[model samples]
Target: MNEPLTRQPEPEYMDLDDEAVVYAEADFADVNAAFVERLIELTPAPGPLLALDLGTGPADIPRRAVAARPGWRIVAQDASFAMLSIARRADRAMGLVQSDAKRLPFAPASFDLVFSNSILHHITNVEPFWAEVKRVAKPGAAVFLRDLARPDSAERAHAIVETYSGREPDLLKEEFYRSLLSAYTPGEIRGQLERAGLAMLDVALVTDRHVDIWGTVP
Candidate 1:
């Protein structure tokens, strides 16, 4: 496998096009719902749990989580005000916060469960993400994080985009390709976890283009 691209953060303005993102992500609900199911099955937190959804773009995954696991109050945060605005309109049950993932506003050990999907690739340096996640999660808190795994080569990345996003709009397909190039491999993620002292979390390739890191906060 060829190396992943040098990390490049997505443009800040991309999040402002909430409608475009929502449309692009419409077909991904089932797979994301499965992510929630696997997370719950892996770490069964008790009811009335406090959950944090970091980088909850459009809050699609969190919305699924709330429906599948009732009484689990969720505070979903994203840096984008436009995205949060759309999420708030779509679902009022969960609290919405506009905040950076690297510097959360919550108190230490404030959450029983923490999860994020497809957000890792967006961070140019992932250390702060690991730090903040560890800081806010309560001891033994369930954690589930997932992101697209970078392909071995540009050709492979193109194939992935063609296979998965062939029917999507031109802009969405191009964005997906860029995201694939920007994603990290499993080994890279393991290294990141070790450096962040988060190696205790179980890391695995859960799909062709996805890697999941899940376990309790240790």
Candidate 2:
């Protein structure tokens, strides 16, 4: 497989528009809504929770969090202005910010929960991203991360992307394949969490493409 893109690309080049295509093709919006609700129900109440949605793509997860826990204060952060623009247009009440996952612009212990979905696989520096998550989250803060699990083969990765995109995404194929190659196994993810000063609480394969890992600040 070709090497993953080293630097962030323009949102248009990144095919932010394709998010809608993928969501529709996979019916992920509906599935994700239910999954988010279930995740919220499973989580213990962190009273008056201050939540951060890292890589808050299109703010779907953030919106779900807000709806599930009306009292929770949420900060939605994403690097793509196009994604953020779509999110802001959909929900005026959302607390949205444009920021990188690897370098969050927040003070230490600023949040009680940090969540990300379909985003971690895009990260080039997993260590720093997890470190920032740890740094900004309060002690004992909950963290929920869901990302594509490593594929068995590059062909599988490409097929999956094409399945959702409805066409070959040549511009992103290399990056997408690399992302799968770079993805962590359950054990590897847990190990990384430990190294990042987080204690793993739960880990599961949520679907064929997604792994759900939750942990807490050490």
Candidate 3:
């Protein structure tokens, strides 16, 4: 049996508008593009595939997924209504749904793929979140998770965020650090997936700070 360390209560302030959180500056476009390319490469199956973009901030992943594969149908869900509004306004292809990641409002085996980026660590309860993912995704469906790994110090995380966004995100800095403290190492992530009944396919450290864990539903 696998056990998660540092369990904490979910914070109310974590639900920020995706547009506000994501598009703090123009450079986020490049970041979004890079994530989109990675997601495309990870799942190359021809669509009419059903995709659920968990924490679909500003619906970037869903928008990019639709652009990459026109036959794909995306359910863009977020806990923030403001984010869903931004997503709906930005992309016509997305079906916007406001919901929490830990308790997805979908039927069992409802999706062919589930993708999330930089959102898992924000969640406080790992077990329920993974359980919901397993419930909603079909057997053999692909899951992609990208998040910051544990850092030696909060300063390192803040420095990276500052470098990426070109400004200090003071409000988000402490939260980011806390999230990292609770984040999974490569081994820990694979263990969590296996315990959640997901079959691991690949796990890679994309950068010193970021890790990508891909797996299939068993």
Candidate 4:
């Protein structure tokens, strides 16, 4: 019988200067582009938009999003100063803020869209994080979040890492395995959504290794 995967929490922030820079420089063009494209497809709203991209590691998604939808005005926020500093170097018209996801600094209803990619598993207290995401969103705001899904066992996780990140360096492959171990399952995420009053959001396994939660706030 396969061992059940247990949730393993990782550091909340990727603040190490060297590591953050290395991460920011890595080639994530394909995945980042796909995320931006999917988000745009999910939200067909026209005109200028005030959007928030949480855990905006290197701000690659925001950069792609703005290029595709010129009307989007994104504020890329991250808790890691190292990550944000790297993102700051790139000339961008959108805003950037360094704040905790559980206690965002933005005002209520401040964003037309509140979205994040792969930040949920890092949070220790996800209920507050979900509430914060809900709080910052405008009425009818679109909420889109995506992150890895924990596999059933360490072996499965390792196989997944090898399949997807085989060409990547050992450092990234190790990190990817850790992230997979730390990831939340779709069922667990559904329970989080229920408790956080975000039950309206749909939680689904978007890919073999990732889960997606999305819906318009009521």
Best by TM-score: 4
lDDT of 1 by residue, 39-68 (tens): 679656547888999888778888888788
Indicate whether candidate 2 or candidate 3 has the larger TM-score. 3
Each prediction's whole-model lDDT (CA): 0.82, 0.71, 0.72, 0.89
lDDT tens readout by residue for model 4, 1-218: 76678899888898988768767877888888889888998889767999999999988899889988899999999999899878888855558899988889988999999999989988878988988999999999999998999999999999998889898877788888889999999999999999998899999998899898999999
Minimal lDDT window, size 10, model 2: 5-14
Candidate 3: which pairs clash?
A: none
Indicate the residue-level lDDT of 135 in model 2: 90
Which 10-residue span in candidate 1 carries the lowest summed lDDT?
A: 11-20
Candidate 2 lDDT by residue in tens digits, 76-155: 98887767777888799899988787888899999888887767766656799888988998887877888777766666
Clashing pairs in 1: 2-152
Which pairs, if any, clash in model 4?
Answer: none
Better of 2 and 3 by lDDT: 3
Clashing pairs in 2: none
After superposition, candidate 1 runs with Cα above 4 Å error: 1-9, 18-25
For residues 40-100, could you state the per-residue lDDT of candidate 3 as single tens digits?
Answer: 8878877689988888777777777688888888888888876666767777657988888
Between candidates 2 and 4, the one scoring higher on lDDT is 4
Q: For candidate 2, what is the TM-score? A: 0.77
TM-score for each of the candidates: 0.92, 0.77, 0.82, 0.97
RMSD, every candidate, angstroms: 2.0, 4.8, 4.2, 1.1
Best to worst by TM-score, what's the order? 4, 1, 3, 2
Segments of candidate 4 deviating more than 4 angstroms: none
Worst lDDT 10-window in candidate 4: 85-94
